[model samples]
Target: MKSFLTILFFVAITAFSTDTVQSQTFPKMDTSPMDLAMARPDRNTPPIARVIYSRPQKNGREIFGELVPYGKVWRTGANEATELTIYEPLKVNETVLQPGTYTLYTIPEEDMWTVIINKNANVWGTVYKKENDIVRLETPARNAAAPAESLSMVFRPENNGATLMIGWDKTYVEVPFEKVK
Candidate 1:
């Protein structure tokens, strides 16, 4: 009878542990589709940065107008949203940014675009309030070198830091913020 009880206890422990492990390893429900609503979706590769998201990129064909439409707040990628993150102090245009992470926001238009550096983080894309935003600046549209068939936010390598370039259609705009000492 003692041996029988010991066997039962072991079986119960193993089952409970297995259940716990399975729950922990269960696949996380995809939130990238909901994350990149405002930004144009990249067809080839999802535009959302991978490191920023805990899950695999939310990517699919026909995501732009069909899934993610124009003229909205984009999380910048999969996960909570694309955080306008910064580690060191940064200077956008004339404004000074202290050490902090911020939500990068944008207001798109036909001729030009309004890109903003908000103080708010941990927001679901633009779902949170915009009042916490520190600075909102507009960048003039730049002519694309060639027609880009994708919605891409490319950070071109620079000798110092790099230029953050946002491109869609034929019009593009750039914000060059150098790393501060």
Candidate 2:
């Protein structure tokens, strides 16, 4: 009985010690935390589309033409390449996008932004292959009403469809998605 008690005490100590070490070694919070945006007409309705991405702060730095350079493919937001999932068929720039998940990439310019929907998802950073592109559309960029400290994306309902509004710093762009006819 004494041996059994000794063994139990050692096991308890080992478990508590392991937990302490793990707590101390756990990774710190990411500088760019992941975020999610969904498209739905109302809060009670099911979402038509979803976007999972990371939000990186501006920190008073130039965003568009500098931090995210022009004429270069960007992952759209931050880490883990922006993921877009469509629950239904949608049309963008006259191209039909079937119901599936896709990676959203962008090429930002001074006045316009090229939105690319790639078949590849779950990619990290700016790993882009031209052959993997399913569709690309040009969207005009405009000045936002106010500066967005963090990169942000939201879906606004419009004309029985949805418009994805992306904003950072003082620049904003809109990508319209329509129901497939």
Candidate 3:
């Protein structure tokens, strides 16, 4: 029965090796991945504003007013706090924000959304303090004709500035800002 014992030993060793390898390997599923979007004034010019955030997929789930909830401060994105960098000073809804990096947070509501730019940056999750907020502007929330499966932020260049558009599911909000002279 030496051959039988040898076969059993080989199977045991193989199973143990497989278990060890699997345990040491990273997880195959990545729930949320980091994403970057930027806005440039001109084709040849450098980006005036940049946003870094993690895109969370819908996954056939109800996003707004449910998963994200309403009237609560959201991190604005997944993983690390959503970050925004401005290369130049800009006026966001008549409030002048200096050229620097800031963390973006939002309070989503059924009718309106409050966009907050805080001094805190590179934070984890929805840990926000009102004392750190630089500006809080309420913007209109519009309904999208089609649903968005993934969260997205876009900058639409206007006459002398750009509008930051944040969209998810079937809702979106736009924050218009002007470049200060």
- TM-score per candidate, chains pooled: 0.55, 0.87, 0.84
lDDT of each: 0.58, 0.92, 0.91
Instruction: Give per-residue lDDT, candidate 3, residue 59.
Output: 97
Ranking by TM-score: 2, 3, 1
> Residues 11-42, candidate 1, lDDT per residue (tens digit)?
99999999998888857765433322211123
lDDT preference between candidates 2 and 3, better one:
2
* Per-residue accuracy of model 2 over 1-181 as CA lDDT, tens digit each: 9999999999999999999988888688898899999999788988888999999999888888899999999998888999999999999888889999999999999999999999998999988998999889999999999999999999998767799998899999999999876
The positional error of residue 26 in candidate 3, measured at the CA in angstroms, is 6.8
**Residue pairs with backbone atoms closer than 3 Å in model 2 (clashes):** none
Query: For candidate 3, lDDT tens digit of each residue in 1-181?
Result: 9999999999999999999998998877668888888888879988888889999999999898899999999998899999999988889877888889999999999889999999998899988999998989999999988888889999998888889999999999998878898
Residue 146 shift from truth in candidate 2, angstroms: 0.5
